[model samples]
Target: MSDTTTTSLLDAITVPAAEGRAIPDAATGETMGHAPVHDVEHLNRAVAAARAAQPAWAALGHAERSAILHRTADEIDAHAEELARIIAQEQGKPLNGPGARFEAGGCAAWIRNAADTALDPEVVFEAPGTRSELHYGPLGVVGAIGPWNWPAMIAIWQIAPALRMGNTVVSKPSEYTPLSVLAVAELMNRHLPEGVLTVVSGGRDVGEGIAAHPDIDKVMFTGSTKTGRAIVKSSAGNLARLTLEMGGNDPGIILPGTDVKAIAENLFWGVFINTGQTCAALKRLYVHDSQYEEVVRTLADMAASMPMGPGLDESSVLGPLSTKQQFDIVSSLVEDARSRGARIVTGGEAAPELGPHFYRATVVADIDDGARLVDEEQFGPAIPVIRYTDVDDAVARANASDQGLGASVWGSDVAEAVAVAQRIEAGTVWINQHGTLNPDVPFGGVKGSGYGMEFGREGLKAVSAPKVITV
Candidate 1:
């Protein structure tokens, strides 16, 4: 393999944690690769390099820096296939699964948006000899601690904006899925200056190093709320600027008179797209009692239709969970839901017939608010459905969670659907649809899902040190 040894961080860098670790394909449970568990000593080296690079990168004019970022998009496009393969092997998501290509496309979009729309602070001049200006500048190097879910794509959400704003970065991708980030970093740096972007991989210790680094001017994290809170506490000493995109238990609602069969397709892919291991995947669903049966039947049919296999197989629609812990979590959630008197309408067990690390796309019905599956972020393929007598009740049930990451309200009636959508407490609410993202708009969440936005000018704006000049 072109990547198994050459671009391997183990061969490339020396670290204490790099001693020995096996990287296996999640789909087939085969040892496809290995990578170093980068230690703090290695992390410190990357941080120092980033600190040195940030100043020089920032010294470049905005247009020039933006141009470099734009070029990065082109480089990513050129290397999409290679990156995708690495992502599939290490992360165990399929080659066709949304990996390098999707991520590279997002990088293109974000950098372009940051360079264009996400502006420097506005400059205002009043008629009576009063001048006021707001300008943005990079915050030196940034520390990015990313999760394992969708490694390359989400990491780009941080790296793209930070780079466009001329902030060098030392990002630690989740140890559970480090190969994608390692390959992405290697490929990206080939098109960029050496120290502009660095990827260091390890477990929690490496993450701690990035969070507490004195040279790091800002910190961006995408992971669990528990970890995010700890990051904030650690960042207190340096008071480094922070942005956290945490977990979600996003709701999906179906109202009366809705075309159940038509939406079944969208809902299926939306929830189980990546084995339902998504931040915004439909965890808790509310259906109007009048149409509950139809919706349930439709969803079940759709889930059953999806093809599953080892990633290399063309027939595979769903792959395995990235790690053993996630598999256990999904399995336990199903066992709990079943024990709580929920109906397992479709799937509820590990598909040993499929292979290791594979879990069936589970669906549960007749769930209530108090059920563990109802109000929690499953982050798996299992979805629990609850029926409501009234639209208001459905809306109430949806908004009951402390997490406000994303939500979707569905119906044939646009007016009614949008109205219910307004009542949703999420940061991004879709009408008649589920997950979708672009570089132009701000993306983040409220409450426990964390604070601050990413993507577009909003993301670039976050990396800048806002200065207010008034005369």
Candidate 2:
């Protein structure tokens, strides 16, 4: 889309307010638009509006709600390009590759899946005279707090199920990328009833209010572990149900004798997708000593070849870091690794020529477990490849982290890979891929990564309360 058209789209959704925050394009640092700065009072008003509208929304029954959800999905499909453009501008993800466009299409697909997934009341217990049926009913208003990494798509992941299960929603988008989410909410509201869905763009106060609001029946949040802990504490007043998808320092293991060349592309995308800002992206790799050199070489070559530039560029698959703060974090981690004698196989520097936030994709080898880059969730365009002599030891090291969001095993022997995957202590374990999600599969984290699941039937249930009736 042209700059004029992009500005027009943002203007259409931008709320006019005396108090607002300027939103900047992630690539160029240009002011894209403004988002109304909502406070706790605005959050309260939004919760009240959602609560007042929820009963009627629930009374519409599953069939009508499902129909409306399907229509909303269609609307999302209609405006997918516009939403993708907004995401590219605000979130620093390229329009091409597995970036803005992929996320936009995912929103529609997930909404449709939520609509079609069967969640009818089921008979849990049956006898001659006694019968019990379990039903899932709306839990009133749902508070959705989304992250900046996948702003629009993750909002849909929270909103779609909540709305599909017959609940009104009040969402708080991350401060860094509120425009992308606001634009999405604008498109969805075209089909949804007034007050049934609201997006309050603000800072930490608004997010805390959403978690602590008494009228809000549940909170769905995706962000950092530190912030997730704060939300957990905030939810204590009313004990609102929470589904938190938090920090993930996922690991990938390459078993002995694996074909490094065949899986190089998948591995590269797994570590570098969205410039590695993804919550579940593979942050560290444990390669067997036999193929460690080959794996490092393959990844470094791929990292050096991918173009890192502005998100709007047609040929740019890799884009800038979403924010300067994130860029600093990634840079610090890599610098620490370099100081500790880790090999910076390809890139270890920033690309200020492209933009203030651009960092070249990096591959670090000869890194061990104690280094900050190997231990922390780097969440940027960098991966540390550690060599291991034994498969069991590798599995043990991968499972040693506090975060257990996702893990992957790569090997020529399918059974061996599956065996290694089974031993990992993570919410989801992939055989040959990493961070690949499907609408039908359940996804979430364990331990410090956060609790509760999101996606498919479990996601539907997470937003609603269950009632058992024995007759």
Candidate 3:
């Protein structure tokens, strides 16, 4: 514990990291990308090791386990920049994306929230002959299915809470972005119990295996709604616990009287940051008639001006779309939108010259409500603007999708904006800013956007189970 680098702590464990090996590029095949390379077989072995080591880990007193969690938080902070770089490489996000900050911050937040905030069992009611109490307990092993867009950050999103509650984890990082997690898992194997947490790397089959495994007590997933449904149906057989943050067609409503330019910047960040790969990215925009043209024009100009290149490059404001599958999805969505009569005011195609998978930041305007681009979770670097006559109508249209994940309201009048925001069916509603996340606030979705919270006190409780005892 005295060694700040976690050096002595790591020295206590038996598993050594894969040494002197070259790392692979998550987005491309040419470079070390970011972190040390690992093998899929190695990841599988580590998780099995964790499963074996979990009973002892679970047997630790809550206080003892909590102290160790704090140590892990410190280790995360010490490696923030390095991990951020790895995340950028592995997830194909811009180095400036909140990955590094989110990784370190989320770990500390989850540890504190889970360990300090979760309720303890106490005698609540007693019969004349009996004493009754209720408390939370850890599930044996958690199977976490994380998306590539947020490899490191999302892993911590699940790991911190699960570990704090004394549950082991067998996390499946995106095949495209596994190293950042491998790094974390390696650190864990060295510092914590060998099987307290592990990473299992493969494709969707690995996900299926974890979901169907009898030993996995719960399944927490962050990805598309279609996949979420499959996970739900498959997991129902075992009556496993489920936490999902699925597809989001989040809407951003620009109400009248807002400074058109300022709100436009917020919209740009909402949709374009992380190259529009976030689950909460503003996929749909509803601007009041008074500000429709201005909002569209301003958003188009800003989006068009964004620099697209490699994320590790200093000048790049946007990076490649992570994997070739994402690149194709973005490209196809853009094409489908244009073919269905959406106006391509800014970017609408892949820029092959940028790299193997770089796509321009796209802003599609004049798209109707029925257009696939306007109503679906694009999950790409594109936002389609739709105009509405009334503020009520804007809210109505924004709420018109099956997915309700995150949304934002922009207006000079905070009271009116709040009233309008209250009507939208989403897990989080921002008054002005969009796509912002905080550790204290809960984040998740409603409807097909999936269920359960991932942060704050609600999140702390969700990853654990309550047990009642009567004597």
lDDT of each: 0.79, 0.91, 0.76
lDDT of 3 by residue, 1-471 (tens): 234354432232213334323334544646553333335455566557767877788789678887787777666666666666666666666665454445545555655565565456778889899998877778778889888777777788888788877789888887677677766665445467766887775677778777777677889999888889999888977778999999689998888888886666776888886788889988888887787788888988887887776666667677777777877877887898889878898888778787788778888888879887887777878888988888888888888889988999988899989999999988889988898887678889998899998787677678778888988
Q: TM-scores for all candidates? A: 0.94, 0.97, 0.88
Off by over 4 Å in 2: 1-7, 15-19
lDDT of 1 by residue, 247-321 (tens): 799999998999886777778877886787778777888988999888888888777777776666655677778
* Model 2 Cα RMSD, 1 decimal: 2.3
Top candidate, metric TM-score = 2
Residue runs of model 1 more than 4 Å from their true location after superposition: 1-20, 97-101, 104-118
What pairs collide in candidate 3?
50-195
lDDT of 2 at 94: 95
Candidate 3 wrong stretches, greater than 4 Å: 1-48, 97-118, 122-132
Give the clash count for model 3.
Answer: 1
Tell me which of candidates 1 and 2 scores higher on TM-score: 2
- lDDT for 198 (candidate 3): 72
